[model samples]
Target: MTHEDVWRAIERFATEHGMSCSGLAKCSGLDPTTFNKSKRWSKEGQPRWPSTNSISKILSSTGASIQDFTKFIEPHGTERQ
Candidate 1:
């Protein structure tokens, strides 16, 4: 999937798990702004993706598997896992 797709999944995962962007970052031991909207885009307007290490940390914090997160990347109205 595209970087934006992955980021959107991350956002959905956090919300589904009852955490705000900052809350997820804190729980994942990252800077509170790590997942903030401001970080989703670069100064050049290019998409900014989460690092694998950050993804792992967030997965651990939420107890969600990669498969579970991937479910969020399915079509906008599709069923969720």
Candidate 2:
């Protein structure tokens, strides 16, 4: 998936759970700014992806499977894992 796709999924996942990105991050034991749009990029404008640890914490806290998270990833690219 693309960086945009993953971030979009995280946004959709948060909305699906009735939480903002900040709320999701906090609930998952991360800093509240972890998922902020600002945090999704670096000062040099490179894409900053969410960490696997961050994803794991969110899934664990929300009782969501990796499959569940994957569904939010748009199939707009040819990349596969």
Candidate 3:
């Protein structure tokens, strides 16, 4: 998925889970700014890719499986055949 798409998914997921970006980061054992919009943008104006470990932690904290997160990352109708 595109970086913007990924971020949007993450943001939506966080909201659905009743967690703010900082709350998600705390739940994931990351710095409060880990999921911050500012951190999502790099100095070069590129999107900072999230690490697998962080994603795993986020999933764990949200009590969500990888498959669920995958759906967020690539929602049903948005997927290509």
Candidate 4:
């Protein structure tokens, strides 16, 4: 999936859980702005990928599985890094 897709999935997941991305991050014991939209892009216009550890924490905090997150990737097709 594209970088954008991953972030969107995270956003969707947070919304589904009745929380904003900042809330999700806080619930995961991460910085409140960890998933902030401003952090999604770099000044150069490149997408900023979330670290694997962060993803894991998000999934654990939300009680979601990798499969659930991966599903978001399918709708957009796999992206060539």
Candidate 5:
């Protein structure tokens, strides 16, 4: 999946779990701004990647298995291009 697709999935997952970006970050033991959309953009206007540890904590906090998150990483109906 593309970076854009991954980001979209993350947003959707957070919504489905009834979480704001800051809420999710807090649940993951990260800084409140860690998952904020504003922080997604870097100084050069490029998207930054979420850290693996943060992702892991988020999944655990939401009671979602790693497999579920992985599926989001490569959702169906989205071409692999």
Candidate 6:
């Protein structure tokens, strides 16, 4: 998936769970800013993808499968870098 697609998936996953990105991160035991919009990009304009550890934590904490998260990548146009 494209960088934007991946971010969008995370955003959708959060919304599906009735949480904001920051709230999801917090619930997953990560720093609240871990999924903030500002953290999705670097100062040089490159995309900053989410970490696998964070994804695993979120899935584990929320009882969502990888397939469930990947479904959100399907051209929904949510978040972006």
Instruction: Give each model's whole-structure lDDT.
Output: 0.84, 0.91, 0.80, 0.85, 0.76, 0.89
Candidate 3 lands at a TM-score of 0.82
Give the winner by TM-score: 4 or 5: 4
lDDT of 3 at 8: 70
Worst 10 residues of 6 by lDDT: 72-81
Candidate 4, pairs of clashing residues: none
Best by lDDT: 2
Q: Between 1 and 5, whose TM-score is larger?
A: 1
Q: Which is the leading candidate under TM-score?
A: 2
Query: RMSD in angstroms, all models?
Result: 2.5, 4.0, 3.7, 4.3, 3.6, 3.5
> Which digits, one per residue and each the tens of the lDDT, describe model 4 over residues 1-81?
677788878887887788999999999999999998999999999889999999899889988999987765645655434
Q: Per-residue lDDT tens digits of candidate 1, residues 1-81?
A: 677677778888889889987898899999999988889899999988889999899889888898987788855545365
TM-score of every candidate relative to the true structure: 0.83, 0.90, 0.82, 0.83, 0.77, 0.89
Tell me the tens digit of each residue's lDDT in model 5 across 1-81: 666666766776787688887887787788988877777779998878887888888898899987777666665476344
What's the lDDT of the predicted structure labeled candidate 4? Answer: 0.85
Q: What is the full ranking by lDDT, best candidate first?
A: 2, 6, 4, 1, 3, 5
Candidate 6 on 3-77: residue-level lDDT in tens? 888887888899999999999999999999999889999999999999999999999989999998887886544
Worst 10 residues of 2 by lDDT: 72-81
Query: Candidate 2 residues 29-74, lDDT tens each?
Result: 9999999999899999999999999999999989999999988998
Worst 10 residues of 1 by lDDT: 72-81
How many Å off is the CA of 69 in candidate 6? 0.9
* lDDT for position 41 in model 2: 91
